[model samples]
Target chain A: MSSTRKSQVQSSKVASEQIKTQKDIDMESDEDRNDENRNDNQQQSRPKLSIQRQDGDNTNATYSFLNEDHTLGNLLRNVIIKNNQVEFCAYSVPHPSEPIMNVRLQVAPSCGDTKKVLKHGLKRIAKMSDVLTEKFQNALDKYENRMSD
Target chain B: MYGMEQINTATGFANAKFGSSKGQGAKGFDEPEIRILELSKYVIKFELLNTDLSVANSLRRIIIAEVPTMAIDLVEVKENTSALHDEFIAHRLGLIPLQSFNVDQFNLSDQCACSSMCAQCSVQFKLHAVCSDRDQMEVNTRHIQPLSDAPIIPVQYVNDKGIEEDPILIMKLSKNQQLDMNLVARKGNGKIHAKWSPVATCQMRKEPIVEIDQDKINRDLDIEKRKEFVALCPREVFAFNDYRNAVEIENSDKCIQCIECLRFAQANNLERAVKIAEREDKFVFTVESTGVLTPEDIVSRALQILMRKLYELGTQMKKYGVNAD
Candidate 1:
């Protein structure tokens, strides 16, 4: 009886060891699956940004228009001036009811002509705003008409 | 007197006949001979020999008669446009979410006899755009053809906005531009295809048709049931035909024939009495191989079916004192 009891104890110890090892494997597999799922979710959720280079190089700085309330002056002041070009980026809003920030930068004939650059850049910016505003007004008129009907 | 000359340049002769001539003293007949020739400056010459000179002269007079000549001219025009413009318009109209667009190569060809490379009917353009938005956008394209009469091939454009499970946008060129492209084939052929313009096909509302069968219509004539069907209809095509005291399917012209109505009717036991007929004007609805029938034919057939069902329903409703609309 004692011998049989000893054998039973040994077998139980072996079975318990097996179960412990299997549980460890299962835990590792679960962690691996969780990691894969997280990676796939991140990849799917990330937004893809389209960038086009006007001059075929990063030298001609390009800015993305982010439809947000950020000021252009603040963005320019913060972003580093690289390769003699400054890029301004912004997002587009869903509706015209939202406020739009007008970012204007001066272009000087000579790099040293700061005053002329500022003047010319401001003028160009004004023209751009006028064109954009006209488009917005037309869109507003259409929306209002639809709402009335 | 007229001079006689041999015209050697003549390739063939017409209106010549051979016959035996008659001898004078012995009363013997002799064969008459004639030579036919063509001359320069719109003239034909004929010479007669032997006994029957009078017959040869008559043939010559008839042969020199004025002949008419005709001239004809043919002209053909060839046109081509760049496919990039289409992508640009789709992008601008929010049909293609800005982020989902990729700058993959695009190529298009039409049924022109020219090889796929010919300017008469081929276009290719490439674009690369990445979506930078949180909301998904849906784009549906309609009637992207060189001509308005040309067949419409469905194209899809989408942004990252993932708003709905099934999103679609419809696009078409303005009627005037489509007409001009069809008419002024030479000048307008290649110009319209090159660049994407903000034309009216973009940002237009999608009109869909819903057809209800007339056969299975419920005789109980519940006004609430009719209203429920109309409310469930995505296109609002259901209307009450007061004249027949029955539900009338309105705007059958807009039906894409998706068979949503059939499913609805089956579930509700709305009598299978209604026969839904698709509109002939749907973009992909093509004439059968027999040939294209006129609008009148399609309408008459639809009306015939509709009227028959209305009459049947009218007879049933008369027992209930309900008049057919």
Candidate 2:
């Protein structure tokens, strides 16, 4: 009975040591935790865009868009640049593995709010794409009908 | 507003529908136009005019990466004696393009209500091949059978004579070797895996603009120089007109902006004799499909996805109260 109790104590001690190692492993794998967060974030389908304004400067800000790439980034940047109030606008994908795009904007002093320009750009792109969809559908129908004939 | 001034050629700037000028806002931009140049079973060439480069690039990117399609995502191997391992066979199965015209009927697996998989989110397929009589049996995509009534099937190609071509080969099995497996096809986009991409290639290029000053070339350079200048162009963009005895633009559209002829002319003291530039508003696009979907269907579906993204962003912006206008 004494031998069995000693063995049991050793096994319990090993179990506690394993738990400590598991915690250590978890602490080491911050990327895994971030990946889980990202997956959960995607599952939740939350709004992926956020804005960060510069300290004491409303005209200068950075827009962080999750789950976006160069496709939307370049489009929005080009559209915003068309606005005279926008001094400069550029976008970059921070990491290839991370689906995130950061668009830095600096507008002229005359335009104090950077979000307004961003909203305008998004609206413009929406309208442009809407018209493109209609036109593309029409063109496709015409081509198909012609081919059938 | 970003378009540089272009010198009109003899035939004029044919592709540019709307030219942007200085100080123009986004509201001044006109609606983009699409003209289908060529359409075939596997390839499509179209011209997108009156649009920014960003729009054209976005469409290309979306067509290649964002369009949803059905592909084998998971496999359950019950038995296998073939030379290939289970994971190897599973990977090969995943790369096979499946008929995805009705992909909208299925929901994305992650968004589905079922615990892991169901009819609404996945299509079940069974593949069984056994080689007993033949010395060696060549397993092809035709071995895959849809377990359910789902419309998903391996893409089949047909020749011009209405004859079926050779189906895609999955593996080869020797005598007495067999493979039995169950495949689950899920709807996904290329962003997850390239195997789910509907298009084989989606590419865009700016329309080339070429301008030649015939008078300047004839007066400034002699016959030998003119001949040398014409020979400098690799694309045959310039040809010497024997009847007129002057150098002329032969096929301006064929110019790839190599700038050989332009450099030659500049060396001969004719700076503005030849100019080459790409139009910012006009883009030529070519989309090739993997036979899972038609080129037209892929293009239209890509446009729909892009528009959906834009709408989502716009609505989110409104929700964030960013609309000052």
Candidate 3:
């Protein structure tokens, strides 16, 4: 009877140890998952933003915005205003990894007194749109190249 | 007394028989009144003869006087030949070298005919020069014509010397050497004199006749006088119409079709409301006198005729107790 009791105690201790070891293994795995998630968050937050000037100052006024990336292109596609006066719409991601900012603008007539809403109001919005589009395409190209590398 | 009376009676009867019988016979004869017909025709004839002695003479005199004394100056040149050396050779041969070729600056006061075209007041210029050695020299110049024929003048200078003519220095004052001579003859014989027609004959067919809004006429007369065409028409035309609110034409037929009304409207800062059309049946009676007359004289005559008609109307109105004022 003593023998049987001692054996049973030893087996229970071993089982407990096994359970503790399992728990430790689970904790380590959870910690590893948390570290991976943190790394992912850091990568997302460090996205690069690019700015490009359309017409490059040659126009009456220049517009600058981030380069176009997936996010920027998506933002541009969401433009709602489609008026006769609205010339163009574009999205720019200043950095390849950054969020995109979409800009909508129009070419105002020379005679009217309406205050321009984009780029200090007086600046021609059409020219800015062109530059933003070019920079966005360039940024996408660069992002593709970086991915390939 | 009886003897005197008998003598006077015999003389009187003889005179009466001779005079009365001849007069009666002349009256009985059916002779055409050709002299009277000719006189009437003469009265209706229109002939114009004009002589602008002063204007023509003054222009001629100015041309003759101003052209010669014109001053010229050298402004620019391009070398094409060695004429400078040839000029030096000519100087060595005791010939005066043509030096410093340039235009004399023209001055009006130096003109001879007092602005008339006379032979005595003209000018000629000669220049001579010598070079130490045989070398090519070029000249470029700009000649300015003060009394430019037209508003703008263009001038160019070129040197036409060849290398073969070098060392000899034989530069001649050819007419080709003249860069630009813009001297305009001021003889006022042509278009200048023709442009100044006598005022009576030069009457522009169109005169402005003001037709105002009857209501506005009285209110705007003072302001209208300050307008550009106040003198374009007579003031009476601005009188009230039947409505007494606006002014209108008093006698539409009396209009001479002068664009005066249009001009008056334009002057008073108004739109062109009146139009002028030709009246074929109403002929313009022009008395072509031999001498010049002022435009005012002709205008006064026309106004006088208008005044006479107005006076007759006024007299009739007075008789009917119509208030002219």
Candidate 4:
């Protein structure tokens, strides 16, 4: 995804596309599970935005992001780690030549749900990235305007 | 803070308090809220709150001395007719910061499972520079090329036309001088050598503060004298507010604490006119990278390295009945 984006210099399109792909991937992961068990888990709890992990248990979750990651994985790990519920979070590309990156998250049982917290943290990071993109554009515009003036 | 005097009253020496009523580093131990004041590909300025002195110092040290990076470690000089000695050229090669994303595949030479030095432990680069022309020519990093199949090594600077330009001049070659060398690069941390240090500059300074006593200024001296007192600072830390007709500290951080601003006040016998000091707890950190890695990446890797070391220390001390968390 990073190669396709080719955003050595960041752009708004690349930023939004990353978030869009992440959301899409999350939804697809959600679809992989049987609907009946998801219904059971939903009926058991009425909490807001309950994100049940399909391929993971309560302890750990691992997801593969193809090309959508490069340095962003390291950043996302740091972001998710801010939460007290997180026991550990790390992302690593298996090899430099490979486009795949794996983000692994571990949550403490004493805290909240792992999947919800991780998803929420990703959302917050996406929003923060968008805000940073805006700030960068504004600063560049201001510098250009000053130069022109 | 509870000094020696406050220690006698409560439940013996074990219960003596220094922090807030909560406990020793308990309340503020939560994840610090990081605020990015400035950022770019090469340099970044950021602030974080709720950090004690040691934690903040560790971060500064990590950025300065812990981030693992790729640097030329061993150089095999096959032939050298240049004025520079072989050892000097090898040392120079060891200091060049190579641009590449360091992968986990390469290990610190000593820690690698391979018995002999191999590709898993090092990357070989060859430099052959000779002035084929009659005039004098300079040798640069562009002359160095990775002889290994792995293409992890890159020049620090690339022009808009995609041509690579060596950021540093390796040496200058005359008509007859020829410098040829084969160098090996390995992944290592700055803790082992300064050449592996990622960030160009990682420094932290206590946040500066300024205190102004308007009543003292107005009562002791006339408006003209007060303006003179403010302008006495060599750093121009003070600027006159035209609307308020008062001399105020416009840029307090510029204060060098030279006590130059105190001259007029002391001359007039009013010593309380102004004060400048640095906050002991609050620190301003600036990190600049060598373009090998982004400044943000440098900071993140610093934090991760520090945390990993602390974790390792905790785990290793478990035999002595110590817990990490």
Best candidate, lDDT: 2
Pitting candidate 2 against candidate 4, the one with the higher TM-score is 2
Off by over 4 Å in 4: A1-149, B1-20, B23-31, B149-151, B158-166, B321-325
Q: Which ten residues in a row have the lowest lDDT in candidate 1 chain A?
A: A1-10
Report the Cα lDDT for residue A63, model 1.
26
| Candidate order, lDDT descending | 2, 4, 1, 3
Instruction: Compare the candidates by TM-score and give the number of the best one.
Output: 2
**Per-residue C-alpha lDDT of model 2 across residues A53-138, encoded as one tens digit per residue:** 85788888899898899999998887777666677788999999877899998887888888888888888787788888889888
lDDT of 2: 0.82
> Which digits, one per residue and each the tens of the lDDT, describe model 1 over residues B1-325?
0022122222111112111121322212222232322221112222223322222222222111110100000111121122224324432332221110111122222224555233333221222222234233222322222333322122233323733333334333322221001111111111122111111111111224344455446464376776666666566567766676567777765555566666767777664544565222112211111011121122123223223322442343344342212
Give the C-alpha miss distance for residue B69 in model 2, angstroms. Answer: 0.4
For model 1, what is the C-alpha lDDT against the true structure?
0.30
| Candidate 1 off by > 4 Å | A1-149, B1-215, B218-221, B242-245, B275-325
Candidate 3 lDDT: 0.29
Two-way TM-score contest, 1 vs 4, winner = 4
lDDT (tens digit, per residue) of candidate 2 on B1-325: 3354442342233223222353344555676799898898889999998887889999999999899999988777777888987778887898999999899999987678998679999899999899999999999999999999989999999886888999999999999988888888888888878888999889899988888887888998999898898898899988998988888888987889988987887888888988999887799999999988999999988888888887877777887777567
**Candidate 2, clashing residue pairs?**
none
TM-score of each: 0.19, 0.83, 0.15, 0.62
lDDT of 3 by residue, A30-66 (tens): 7876786687587555433222344433112223333
DockQ of each: 0.01, 0.23, 0.00, 0.02
